[model samples]
Target: MSNTQGPVLVIGATGRQGFATATSLLEKGWPVRAFVRDPAAPKARELRSAGAELAVGDLDDEDSLRPAMEGVHGIFLMLTMMEGVHITAKGIADEERRGKTVAELAAKAGVAHLVYTSLQGVHQDSGVEYYDAKEHIEDHIRALGLPATILRPVLFMDNFATYNRPTRDGDNLVLALAVLPHLPMPLIAIQDIGRFAALAFERPAEFLGRDLVIAGDLLTPPQIAEILARTAGLTPRSVQVPVEQISAFDEQVGKMFAFFNSRPTPPIDITALRTTLPDLMTLEDWLRATDWQA
Candidate 1:
């Protein structure tokens, strides 16, 4: 274990990626400063108990961010999209502007390493709002000449956990709106991404100025369904829904499917990542390790 000592500021610390990265950094003896919108939030308090210094900051408020970035060695920026039932185009623009502002601030603050969590297939000409928003941030990061590392992670396997049940209409696990039945898309667990981010902060020299597409494993929808069934001890079936059915599906789920089906994006190069961290977990391994019954 390398003895790296410096305060790393994590944005959106209450969220999945932020929480995981903060926990990982603390476990590895790194001083973590979490930029949370509400320090009194349950998650923020939990992070405080786990040895993280919480700083009140919102991505939209530039004034609030300076305090968090001051004297930080590195920053982990993961901008979350709006999950509201109804959001306007103006809302999206505001979110993207805030994210870009944060990147610019991190650069101006002279943070040694800026690790940004981006979405996969964003570089494609898909013109999806969510992906395009991320690309806007990435472009700003590159143009700013910051010592940055951008990580584009695929759909999280844990997305399955959000569905009500394994099957919709009796044993049929609804694979809604996904056109690529046999396409082996890449994915990484939240925990693994956290670990990878921590490692990147530690090895800034190697990772700086790199755009890494990261994934633990590549599996098709059917294969994923089989793995889920095997892990949960049930015979799950797979059903493919058309792209047009996306809007009718749960709005968020629909957007996710549309993103996945836009292109047959290839898996990321994990060779450098593997060299640094060999204990990365695959989907099967994660299922085995997780307490499904709980």
Candidate 2:
């Protein structure tokens, strides 16, 4: 369809990134079609109420995707690995299989621009399953010759709000992942990620064939701990937990930590992205507007 106003199909529209992206597109007056597994889900109902056309589809079923793609101009594709699957079977292999299938199907459907959400540090030879899976998807997207933009987002700022802080109970406390004190990490807000993806679709020609690293701010674990302390009104302490002990924390959490430790370098060009989208939000702005305490 040559009409620029055609709907954009968004997979995973009930989740964080998809919800944000769909909302942004609606606010910008773009017709949005959200692929959801269940039309009865609260999130799906909310999307419909917000003016998004709902399409029932599952990532595990390739045939269900086409109905959403019919006459669509662009798509935002994202897939989450099944929880508690074996590291080999559930983690990397599963992600690769699903991502590849989705990309191939999108290309076959004649999608004009495809925006694939990937992880930061995916291209580096990190030997991590999740990161490797992302790399595999990137490779497949390139091989398909689709007009695509790959967004490698930094660590989620919301992740720290959920997992890093100690429980409200006074007896338990948690610390940072890395053993090295003052080790810096790149982070970005999920809302900003949606904004970035919407802009990529708006200017597909500028973003096509480009791998954009999208990071909001850089901070050490200690700095993050301080932010938590200030935001939560607790005496949060920053301790350097040994990387090997990550598994004891949580299997998937540990694997993620190992991946982070393997490559402690930042990948995105934040300055260049700022040049492209000048109003990008910063961490301070996000925190101020966030309901962390609530």
Candidate 3:
């Protein structure tokens, strides 16, 4: 592999963000070694078909990861809390352990660069358990003296297509979220996150030791609803769900929303980000590109 296009081992390669990163790297002519728990999985097979070499392994098993890290130019670290969305105290602990393990292994393997995808505002004490765990992992990476680029991405725009999708209410779609109507929420496409990761791996001098907060656009729920109506051809109504109601269902998600409401607005400069990543997508751009439907 060429120095600029060295092989990259992408953790969580079958997942949304990891798949994007791996695909972007391959598009840039960089070799990709996708670390996956199951090589037979559809996404993993897709990655292999798209020119990524599959490295079957689980993050929990250090031995499984060591072989994948061998001779890799860089590592893209993406860890899930509790293996999915539901975050418990034990889940938080497991997340930290997994993160620290990856960092430690990367350092041991003498990897050239490590790119970690952390949550936006995780540097601050959000009082959210999972956020705190991510911060701790960041600290561990720094403490290990790893040559790493930390990308703190805002909420994924893809969430609107799945997790926070609008439900049909007669002829109109009801977009109900715990966020306040007027509060501007920063969002980035999962694909954009991958694009940035590839850029970092290609140009380590500009990205190493840097912690970037990335966002494609900042829009309120109502504005997002409007975008959905205009871009996706849907009659959408924005409903601000009570935080308490969400808390009653999912305490972790409720705490996350409460923290979002606590902040007046997320701190992200899209214009500046555009200078770095010219193709950084806006809500409309994402909607049009994905052909998102309610």
Candidate 4:
């Protein structure tokens, strides 16, 4: 376990953040053991092709995770709440259970370090069910006295390409969200989360027991729209849709936005984070790197 060359197990290795982390670890020449439910799945196969050893298992089942933890030095744990994307009570409970089970199993295996990806403001009692669920797992990790690092990432920049993508409105591409036009929202590229996780594993002494809240940039909705328009060659405008409207459409997301509006801004020290990961991508940088054409 003390051996740095030993594999670092990546839970949920097929998902966005997990895939990024597993690839980062492999690129850094660290042996990676990807914990996947289906080793033959596309992303899992992709990891294997890139030199990762697959450990097939489900997070809900503790016995299934044991073999993955065996002989591993560290674990990059991220239980994405895709199951509860709509935010149901059962989804929240299932996520919390999955996360805690991983922490408990990691501790029992005597892994050297555990890096958990959580959301920002989970400690502020935001009453956001998903964030609260993550906080519960964080508490469990601490209570177990596991040597761990917690990375609290802010909003994902990738949201723009999916659910938050701009909609065409006559001559303009309209971007709408529950946040005010002037509120500075912290944003991060998912790849940077992977880079930061790799950094933590590489420098265990500096990161162990630390709770790092990370973001690449902070911009208002209007500012974000301007960047998108300028980079993607589209006429973009941002409108502040009422939180109530958002809640009417998606109750869970509405609660998150309501919490976002309640706070002046999220807690993320980009300046300090830069000292650690100087190559963190800004919105413009991210836009340039991807195929974000309208």
46-98: candidate 2 lDDT, tens digit per residue: 99999999999888787788777889989998777656533444655778898
Q: Is candidate 1 or candidate 4 better by lDDT?
A: 4
Give the TM-scores of the predictions, in the order they appear.
Answer: 0.90, 0.90, 0.96, 0.96
Which RMSD values do the candidates have, in order? Answer: 2.6, 2.8, 1.6, 1.8
Give the C-alpha miss distance for residue 116 in model 4, angstroms.
Answer: 0.2
Show model 2 residue runs off by greater than 4 Å: 1-5, 84-88, 167-175, 233-236, 249-252
lDDT of 4 at 193: 96
When summed lDDT is taken over every stretch of 10 residues in candidate 3, the lowest stretch is 1-10
Please give the lDDT score for candidate 1. Answer: 0.77
Per-residue lDDT tens digits for candidate 3, residues 1-294, read: 235535899998988889999999999889999999899999999999999999998888998999999889999999888635566788889989999999999999999999999988786667788899999999999999999999999988999899898887776777888998989989999999999999999888899999999999999999888888766566879999999998887787788999889965556889999999999999889988998877
How many angstroms is residue 194 displaced in model 3 relative to the true structure, after the best TM-score fit?
Answer: 0.3
Candidate 4: C-alpha lDDT: 0.88
C-alpha lDDT values of all predictions: 0.77, 0.78, 0.89, 0.88
Query: Is 1 or 4 the stronger prediction by TM-score?
Result: 4
**Model 3 lDDT, residue 125, Cα:** 66
- Give the Cα error of residue 186 in candidate 1, in Å: 1.6
